[model samples]
Target: MTPNQATSSTTAHLKPTLGSLQLWGIAVGLVISGEYFGWSYGWASAGTLGFTVTALFIAAMYTSFIFSFTELTTAIPHAGGPFAYSKRAFGPLGGFFAGAATLIEFVFAPPAIALAIGAYLNVQFPEINPKTAAVTAYLVFMTLNILGIQIAANFELAVTLLAIFELLVFMGVVSPGFSMSNFTKGGWAGQDHFSLASLPGMFAAIPFAIWFFLAIEGVAMAAEESRNPQRSIPIAYIGGIITLVTLAIGVMVFAGGVGDWTKLANINDPLPQAMKLVVGDNSNWLHMLVWLGLFGLIASFHGIILGYSRQIFALARENYLPLFFAKIHPRFKTPHRAILAGGAIGIAAIYSDELIKIGGQSLTANILTMSVFGALLMYIVSMLSLFKLRRTEPHLVRPFRAPFYPYSPAFALICACICMVTMIYYNLLIFGIFCLFLALAYVYHAMTVGKRSPMQDEADSNSMTTKTPAR
Candidate 1:
């Protein structure tokens, strides 16, 4: 019940089946969908060159943030990820915000990726509606997640490996057609000739640039599930980031070079559209990419379900939500309720796509912005937690310290704030919707969970420490 006891408790019921390889798979799988699509929205906001600049800057921010986040994850090693760190730093209110932000990020991200999956399938089977396919995907993957962590993680590793190789194949097939002239043909779209007006476009491009590496932080959710938490966490994060950066840059440059970047600028299937230029309409290479390419989207869509469910399970276990959601399955030893809860939301999103439309963009853009909104907030609060923890819990065991200390976290925070502002400015409607969701979550917390003390939360979290069947 005390701080010492809470810190020493292994308060997570999730199975400890993950090793460094599985961690690497989940980390990379969580964000690989971004490399497949959603990033071209940046081109719509800021042209080829502008989006490229945005991506480079955002990549640096993510690389630094991931390095810093590992310290907190290794120390707390909880399923809550950012929520656990922020709670230690700023107490219950802070933890609530971080958890809600994470739920929004990981929960909403899948719908976007699922839609992309549907789009890929529709490319082959015209009879199947994209939204219908998306809903089916949600059912299939979330069930796999609930069955067990070992099964889920094994699938993650297999699919992620396939996805990585697929990206490489895409580059090889399209490399010969790379053209600098095409890449720069309409490199700057919004501004007729760069001006003060161009600043807004470039700033607006921030979130879309972020789409390329958005949920890389999801790996932290697996910390409690790692077979060797302290040793595997850092290696997985470092290796995952390195892999993503390489893929992001390679795919972006080659895709841009192959055709008029503007055409694929806002679509959910940018890579397929990009390759269409090189192979015309019927090349076997194009068919192969479209079919095999589904692996990348599936990896993220599936892996994000894992991340969000862990977050849901963690928050519920800590009494931030109803306790039933925290229940571990009696037979599977997995958080079945939490996985179903998130999957229901994702499936609902597929059908609810047309409910609200903003700025003439499709429902997909709104969902994408919502995810970015959550990610930006999580980055800000998590970065703040890093500073607070360093000052308040200096003696806490940290297996890895961020290389630059204050500077690395501080810089990531600065970039996060700037992106948050730009996203709000560009997608005011989406930002407003996010605010409404946050407000409703807080209201629910106040009604059912506001009176709980910090120690009680720790005790509740400790409930997960019971022995479980080995995977």
Candidate 2:
């Protein structure tokens, strides 16, 4: 047998069961949590008006980014997502950094979402501790993911649909209270007027603004398991981005206009709070908002568990992580070990929430910032890979080319660079912590996985080949 055939024969692949519908579910579910809670934190720094402006620019970046990123995803269609793209374009070291950054984005994001899940439940049952609920969420969803992909994906679709419906209902119910005067008053950096002086707060708010659409790129990680990646991926990505952008703007505007926007700016359950302003605390609609809002948080939490596990599995399969994590469950055909490992890290972060304070920010805020930092770095790397591969691998089969080519990716790249700089400036301590983690990861890579010879590296890459050929 050929060496590539032998290598492929021995490797355990993720079962191909997901299609366009499930792909859309995974894409939107992966990011639905941002709508539930994290984005409101931007209001604290930039106020309603300034934060709205920040969100617009951030939204543009994501719209352009997903359009550009889809090209790389369809061409490679690997579980490693950005790691695989960077590896092809810039070799192993580039892959290592991209993988590390992607890991940070996926791994760190869940704890914050889990905590929000807990906070939402706490609103109804005050006795339930947020941290306990957070850890419980990690355990429950990880088990679901470990059981199988289809089952987990089906669940994601259900919750994502419910979440989307809830947001629409929220906007509809709050329509009466959405006064333009309330929204525009003190909107720009807590001032009635917008000026250059508001720029720092606007810049500082970039990470929170990014929270609105963070992890949407995680959909690419599922490319390996797709039934028809080329067709399904472009559909899922384009449809998902449009859906998320609409919900983000709708929820933000409706909530901000409902009364004092400042009161909803820094809380975990902003939707429920905003709804209570319109419908009263005892209103069934308010209760419904609290209950249904869990769907949004759960969708993102569960979806991210799926995203992070695939990433860990991909890294391990490529030798960047321990081989133990690469093992697929015999009967279930899922990356059980990788799922449990990521869940453990998330649970640890949950327990450490209060303990790991930076700049006096809440655990959700701190972790959200860290996740955005990772995301922005990965975005920069992924766009660079796209540009490099066009020049380097001219013969590569691209089923879906990013429109506007140089300009599309360049705009995405510039925006990502700007966001990264602003995040570092405002979050020095968290940025340092992020750098230290990368440095340690690099050292570990240097000692172990980085030592793979050319032949071995080729074999590893071959073993990771997509199940469906590019169109």
Candidate 3:
């Protein structure tokens, strides 16, 4: 096997053009799609009030998770994000699992967002088939990502501002017509009143709650490309989380309050649907929402494609994946191969589900849950990494630290465990598929890379005179 002597140089060699504001733009832009859809899916599992309760629980989880996670990002400041942390804390195998989960989250996420983009456009102009629109969205964004980080970050900033504005406008327009009665109309769908039976629904609703804040951690993936990741990572990470929580609550209360929350549950474009109900089909608000609301989905879809490429590039640079994925454009200095490769995977995922026509349901939600499953699993592993690192590598420099030390990471870890179990319970089919993929990856690593796990590799590197890859 080729040793990772060049890994450090190649990984750290990435261009660093991103500032704190651009990082904030990418962080927020990466997740603004959550404000668009999928959170309402929780309502299908638990009604409006129950879903709101679930949101609050998840908000706590994310608040704690980001605080704990930021310290790792600031301290480590690697493009691999969770993979680097887990590798440092646990070893190659742990890093693989963490990386795989992140891959599952990022590689699978854009297609879902692409599907949403199509759905949003289709709602405005039915002549546009969602499948066609989704493919187009992938092609356009992949091109933008391939151009350069500077261009991508600038675009992310512009659209992120528009998406944030759109959400505020949505809340304002919907608030005037919101009825408290409508909010509680279906607070708990299956339960006449609160009961023990209602508990599982809350657990089941966890993934949907995750929809509100998924991919926020992806900001860490841009560490190699950031101007001053040490200072910028914490601000962008914390600021992004705060912005999302407020939007999550505002959209939840206002949208549910405007009309039948149950009807809006699980739909592709809940905001537009909710607005149309309140202002009629031809209302200016509906027009503005349908036209501009696309920005929210586009922001996330575009931003996530950028994130996934960096992750793919990072892993490949470390020899965790094929070397071909590590290739950077000579002129652009971007991981063009990784970007195209991820786009190909996303497009294939979109069409495979489209052709199979899974159980007469749109694969968008299923794929979404699948991505959430990966994210929750990664979160659990990463929080564990934080504690492990603190114990084992206490002297490592940390520009930022979690406010509550053990408590913050501990709380996030616990919540991540619960959310992961909940995600598995809710998404058995996808979980099974992910397991099969994991087993195959392990088999491939054992045979090709030999039995030397990431831990062993790190040990080897430390003892060797040759320079090792960046963590």
Candidate 4:
């Protein structure tokens, strides 16, 4: 069957289903825009030493970790995503922390992406205010998202292809100028180079490198909306990561070869600068390609917002959040209210100057480490939940079981722990601050809201029923 016919068939099987291609598109867009650009920016700052090693490390980590997630997501394709899986596997509270951390990651990621767009815009239009661009991009995507998921998904697909194509074409055009010798120009700089006495600076670079791999988890967030999520979600998760890793490595290698490592390292927006070198000055066509890539960035923001809003909607439905956020639009069959709430947060984040500062750090260096810290917390809980559920619900009909049983889950947990230790050792202050916020949020949520059960609402509804007087 043709693509349209296939999509129609898939849609008929499940209401509110996102086709596999669209799911892939959403995953790609979210990972590329939300994670990749920031990652590349981070890599740029660390120079070749950090980039080369960290890229390899991330590729290894992502491959192993994703297989584990694919198993979980495919087994339990619920709206709550990781939160739902955790609840079923561990317990409500375990699920709560997982949901909370995932929520924070999704919430924080959009602003970071928005700030990247604003930074790129600042480069092209030096006269335009960065804050204004950031706010405008956030609002535009927010509006796009509010229209509904289909619109957002379609836009994501289009921009994802555009972004990939732009990068590929740029690479092809610049391939002729590739010079392998440039790679070694900036040989590994020691700790003394950055005024540090020991190897802490080298270790400091891990988080930045880790940042490049951040959005591989986004596929789980799209589980509820995916067409045949049991199959599609896993595929998207695995495929999206592979695609990103391949493209990223290719672009970085090609860009590194085109000029001395120092030149590419110095330019904040490497693609446009690389294009300038290849296409020469006054290349408006290349400028237009960069602009299209920026739109892809914006589309990436929309995809994350789409995934995140659904996550919040799922939480609210479970009574973990306010009921108001749970309301879906009647006609559109979309989580309209939750989308607005997520967008509002993104807009608020644009106002923070600190976001810009954080965005400038090395990809494999700082943010990645911190993000991994948060992601690892969720992963550990998720893996433990997998084991917890195996014992608790022995007969639970899992469509897809993780390979190697306890070994798989055990391995994932170990990897997560290792990443967590690395994060703490590398940047204790930032990681500690994030944990503190999570702790405070949990305490406040527990004290004020957790005590009340969803069952109480049903009981109250029964009690308020009108009784007819004896007639």
Candidate 5:
């Protein structure tokens, strides 16, 4: 490897030792589970036809973005992820926004996942209440995270396996009752119905559907902990995206058709409802197994918290945030402070009005939509950085350069911008709120804790050395 590649390789395996397969499992689980709410909302918005088209659009964009990230991540395998890449390519200000955007995505995502789990459980046990269940689930995962990375990875692996198994069984039981007529029964045109006019609605749902595909890039956050970051990060990144797209398509194809879109859309956990419809309500065994799927959803949340905390830790180390947040446990070598901070934010979000609401019509729905908007904004910035870096650092060693160069990054940038525009069209208020927060964060970072230039710090160090060479 060249000098830069060697540095990248060394930094990639800087800390705790996590296997490639385990990382891939965690990434897949987090991305798939994050979409539970989106799937339900998309189905409600455009029915089955709308949901399927939206799913395809989001999946395609996500696939392309992951490839772009794979190239960047392998070239510079560091823990700060997009933030580090942006800083190197642009400067501190650009890096601040990228890091802030990531922090928003990670912090908000956990509660969203928790809320989905709570909603699903509430469906099975209405008396328990969604808020209580949501809080309880969040706490459980927080505890798992506090325990440490190895334990979290092991738990994630187990949950992903069970989730995959549950998906297969669901597909098998529902396949026997598949109806070809269901595909075209609802027609391909209308508002409450599925039609060509609904195309806008379908496009609107892309952001929501994209939620399910969010955490695929999270593997990059764990780069510092992976066994062989150059090889491991890219493999996990590509592999995770492929796995999720395949599963999503399979589920959409197997879960009957858009004819009963209204019924399926109304239900929070569509897979269970679809299974119930397929098996005539006589399969008690299937009901229990469907509930097991909830565990998978919870596992996905666990992975989200784990990955998000690491990003926080990385930012802290770079002095973008408080130095205390950079603390790593001496024995565990894990970012306990950052993990606790993430857990606290997640707990707060769980209580937010948006998370407590039921349907997609409430403030919680607005925020969830805004989260998608925020994520796409970050994507736009990161993709731009990729192109900028190529021009500015032509000789920078890149172990894995993105294929097609400008075209690949350009494609991702365009798709992300399109998604953001669609989000604004659907709900201008939410997008406005998202941009407002980012602006506020940028101002805060600039005024309160602007990072010092590396050259200045280097000069100070050299002066000190020259003043006392033998002391």
Candidate 6:
């Protein structure tokens, strides 16, 4: 088949159905799970004070990145997200790098969130195993995604709002118990003095700090399906960052001050644990948090399932992976094959949590590190793509230019570089495994996709095009 024909075929398969509201839901929902669990792990390594600093620093990087990244998403409007942006800027190899990194981020994140979901359920029902609960979640959400985009997105919106409200309620309930003295007690990584010793712990906490806002960028994967990409994408991304930052700081500080922050640091359900200190374990507020908290984890898990499937579909559509994954379900008009494939991988990872351990870390901790590795890499490649495209494609219609031009992207790039270096330094073993995953994927991509011809490039460019931004 000709390149033109392939582009035309892909266009017919993916339908635009999302509006700004749904996009906002997806953006926030993609990372809300971070508040519920993962960020607590940072306390184990960095203490409350140390992790708070790391969270604030990482939050700055995301704020700048979302502002800059909105430009590329508006111009390209491709479901491939970072992959599409990088490909247009630097060609196929760049696309592979960004795509692999994104895949690692989106694909691995769900398993960790799924495990959290299982743990949350285990609290309510002692009989159910967390792994079994996790696997059940994978099956259920994947089916929801395969049903259709609107169905999946509407469901995402509902859960995201519920999750956000629950978080706010948590803060209110814990406010009476919050004390600055408690928060600052041994806050400097268990040291009374803020010496050079705290630096290592602070830097080592980058991944968990990153967890607070990770995958919020996955909203870009829905651009193709957004009713108005230029407007909705910006709103979704900007609003998402602000909401997450506020919640992260609020939740972390409140959780820390209410009780023995050390105990909350290493567990999956920190909010409930902290709440128990404020109100006894039998309190309804504690029960409410345990039950409603599932919404936070579910929102992210379900939204990421949507994100990863679109990514898989885009890569397959562009021939970066097997074409089998590119097929759309005729009745549902969704990437059913891609949805199932990603689910299979996640389910495997869920089970492997017990079977695999590296550096004495659980699969959840290792995958969280691995996910951050991918996020940082994708952030770096994406910023470079932004700069390259500005220099090269001077005429690309940008409805929303990044607020500070070079400065915004430059700041984001530098922060991502620092975080990447810190993560690599602290997680050498996981870093090596991340590299091996990319290397293996690249080997397959090189052998199969090879180099793109001029005709194919033109077709990809055409395929990615959508409505122009209103001047």
The candidate that wins on TM-score is 6
Order candidates by TM-score, high to low: 6, 2, 1, 3, 5, 4
Candidate 6 lDDT over residue span 60-145, tens digit each: 99999999999999988998999999998988889899999999999999999999999889888989999999999999999999
Top model by lDDT, which number? 6
In model 5, which runs have C-alpha deviations exceeding 4 angstroms?
Answer: 1-14, 34-37, 187-196, 256-259, 280-282, 354-364, 454-471
Runs of candidate 6 exceeding 4 Å displacement? 1-12, 354-356, 450-452
Question: What TM-score goes with each of the models?
Answer: 0.94, 0.96, 0.94, 0.83, 0.88, 0.97
What candidate 2 gets wrong by more than 4 Å, as runs, is 1-10, 462-471
RMSD of 2: 2.2
Pick the winner on lDDT between candidates 3 and 4: 3
Candidate 4: C-alpha RMSD to true structure equals 9.1
> Model 2 TM-score?
0.96
Ranking according to lDDT, highest score first: 6, 2, 1, 3, 5, 4
TM-score of predicted model 3? 0.94
lDDT of 4 at 353: 42
lDDT of 2 by residue, 98-213 (tens): 99999999999999999999999999999999999999898899989988999999999999999999999999999998898998889988899999888998998899889999
Instruction: List runs of model 4 lying over 4 Å from the truth.
Output: 1-15, 34-36, 44-46, 190-202, 263-268, 354-372, 404-409, 448-471
What is the C-alpha lDDT profile of model 5 across 142-191, one tens digit per residue? 77777778888888888887887777777777777777677445523234
Candidate 5: minimum summed lDDT over ten consecutive residues — where?
462-471
Model 1 segments beyond 4 Å from truth?
Answer: 1-12, 190-195, 458-471
Please tell me which model should have the higher lDDT, number 2 or number 6: 6
Better of 2 and 5 by lDDT: 2
